[model samples]
Target chain A: MKWESVSDFFAMGGYGLYVWGSYLVAVLCVIGEIIAIRIRRRTLYKHLGLRKRSILRGEK
Target chain B: MTINWFKYASPASFYFLAGRMIPYFSIAAIIFLIVGLYIAFFSAPTDFQQGEAYRIIFIHVPAAWMSMFLYVVMAFWAGIGLAFNTRLSSMVASAIAPTGAMFTFLALWTGAWWGKPMWGTWWVWDARLTSELILFFLYIGFMSLQAAIDDPRRADKAGAIIALVGVVNIPIIYFSVQWWNTLHQGASVSLIQSPKMATAMLSGMLIMALAVWMYSIVMILIRARLIILERERHTAWVSELKEGVLE
Candidate 1:
């Protein structure tokens, strides 16, 4: 509602680049952190799974 | 009829509780982010002087606040772990590090973005800016110190000392603009004074701050759960969990 047109919204009164740049960095940081957590969790589970299997094999 | 306050002091119970709570926090974070962004971009009027450039404050202020708040929480848990020797407390302290560092980095990044146009420069060594940069380094130092140690107990104690010592910087960062002349402006939204921003703008910023709060809780909980598993791999409960749950 602040802008008359779509381009005007993106243009951000000619301060578009700075405003959007700050937001873009924020998005990247959030995504990067989530991805890092996922990778760490996966690696951990895989390691634990392997250890469980090895222990079972020894028992058998 | 009284709830057991110390029941969740154990990592095993906390892990399951965190797992169950993540979905709710994640939902709240997502919802708040959507509403906050909508208000920030559409509902809030442009500033008379700075125009759209002032919009950077939406994220910048929130990130900066979180950076400071998370450090205090991290240090609190670290201290509790040191004093009481609680494993969950230590795990929580360690889990908060990377996210706190991320927010600190975001604050600096967004601050630079805001400064480039408004101040005509990307960087300054003003008291506020310099102190914030030091806070960032403190987070990095805590993480690196903990990572350097092989034993978890020693790492937690070492990190706690650094975190507690670094607490002196938070007040400095908060009052830096007042204590000395600086390029960075004084706080617009303070507990002691009425906000200088428009109602809609303040609401949007506050909502975004809540969204960030929920997001941080989700991240820290997830990270703490992972830490619990990593440290308790030899425990019977972890083995049972591994056998019962693929996730």
Candidate 2:
């Protein structure tokens, strides 16, 4: 809204790269945490299932 | 109003409660992030002093605040576990460490980026910066110490001791600017005094701070649920959870 055009907005008055760089890294780290938690849940569940199946097989 | 907190304190109850909380917190985080950034980047006026470059404060301040705040919250949980021997309390402490560490890393990294332009240096060995760096090291040390120990109970005890001890550094980090002539600026926002920044800037930072707070809550709850599942796997409740998942 402050700029004449979209390019001017993206340029951020010549500090564009620094401004965008900081935000990009910040957002990626936020998303990365979510992904990491999901992976941990998946891995832990898979391991739990495997361990239980092995124990059941041994008992059979 | 009746509050049934005990029902939520157990791991089994907390897992379901946390699961219910995730969607609400996650959605709120997304909404706040969108609104905060919109106000920060577009609506917030450029500073007459620092120009557009000053916009970095939108991210840097919130990240730095979260870094300090999360460390304290983590320590609080660790202390609760230490004092009460509550199983869920320790799991909550464990869940917070990694997210706390991540925010600290972001604060340092973004601080350097802001510094390179403002201070004409990427980093300095000043009091505030140095103490913040020490805070980062404390987070790492807490995590590494817990992971090193094989027994979960022992690991929780060890990490709690370090977290409680490291709390002395937090006050040092907060008061470092006032205690010493540091290159870093004093806090613009404080309870005892009026904010030094513009209203729009202050509002943007506050919204972003809330957004980050919500984000941290979601992260901790998710991780804490997983920790509960892994630790309680041998219990019947966990088996039911696993069956629910498999089904």
Candidate 3:
């Protein structure tokens, strides 16, 4: 808010790189965890479905 | 009525309980994060010295605290699993590792960011930072070792051992600033004493810490659910649950 313009906010009084970079990394980590959890969930569901089908078919 | 807390420690019971909990924790985490960010950016006074740079502390300190807290939690679960041979304990331990590692990375990254302006360096080999880096590696090592093993039981045992060993590093990380003269600042807040920071600043930090705590629980619960579904796919309970869901 103190910044004269949008660029000044990004500049972060010359520590912009460090400040923004750190926040960026933190954001990315959260996103990464969400994606990983979703992927793992899908895989688990698939495995469970396959196992159930095999059991119903008496193939296990 | 005796509520058996230990019963929930069973994977099946934990699975359902975690399912019920995930939504609550997620909502709580979101609310806290919004409130925390609002107070941090708007209410907390700008530092007399650091100006805007001090704002980063809101996120940095909470992430740092969660990183350490999660590791201790993971190790605690690992120990419980090892001692009691509880399937859910191992699953919980496994579920927490990646999240813990992510927080560790966040803490380190934020610390580097905070350090650059205040300490005149983007990176330092101070005891705190070095020990934190080691914690990150320990997380990776535990996950990798678990993945490499073919047997789940064996993987759990191996991961538990590694996590227990890594627990030693946690105290070292905590005491690093106190034990050595480092560029990193000492703790502003401790359990035994009132925080050194202004009330507004401390409030923001506490809110952020609560946000991180809730987020960790939600993530771990989601992960543990998946672990239970995988490990118990052959069980009658899972089969019935799958049927109920499908219908």
Which residue pairs overlap in candidate 3's backbone?
Answer: none
* Prediction 3 global C-alpha lDDT: 0.85
Q: Each model's RMSD to truth, in Å?
A: 4.0, 4.5, 4.2
For the second chain, the TM-scores of the candidates in order are 0.98, 0.96, 0.96
**Model 1 lDDT at residue B218:** 96
Interface RMSD of each: 7.3, 7.9, 7.5
Each candidate's DockQ: 0.37, 0.30, 0.32
> How well is each residue in B1-247 modelled by candidate 2, as lDDT tens digits?
9988688789888887787788899999989999999999888998887778888888888889999999999999999999999989999999999999898888888888878878899999999899999999999999999999998889999999999999999999999999999999999799999888889999999999999999999999889888987788899866654455422
- The TM-score of predicted model 1 comes to 0.95
Give the top-scoring candidate (lDDT).
1
Q: Considering only chain B, report the TM-score of model 3.
A: 0.96
Runs with alpha carbons beyond 4 Å of true place in candidate 2: A50-60, B1-4, B245-247
Candidate 2: give the clashing pairs. Answer: none
Where is the poorest 10-residue window by lDDT in model 3 chain B?
B238-247
For candidate 2, give the lDDT of residue B3: 88
Give per-residue lDDT, candidate 2, residue B200.
91
In candidate 1, stretches whose alpha carbon ends up further than 4 angstroms from where it belongs are: A50-60, B245-247
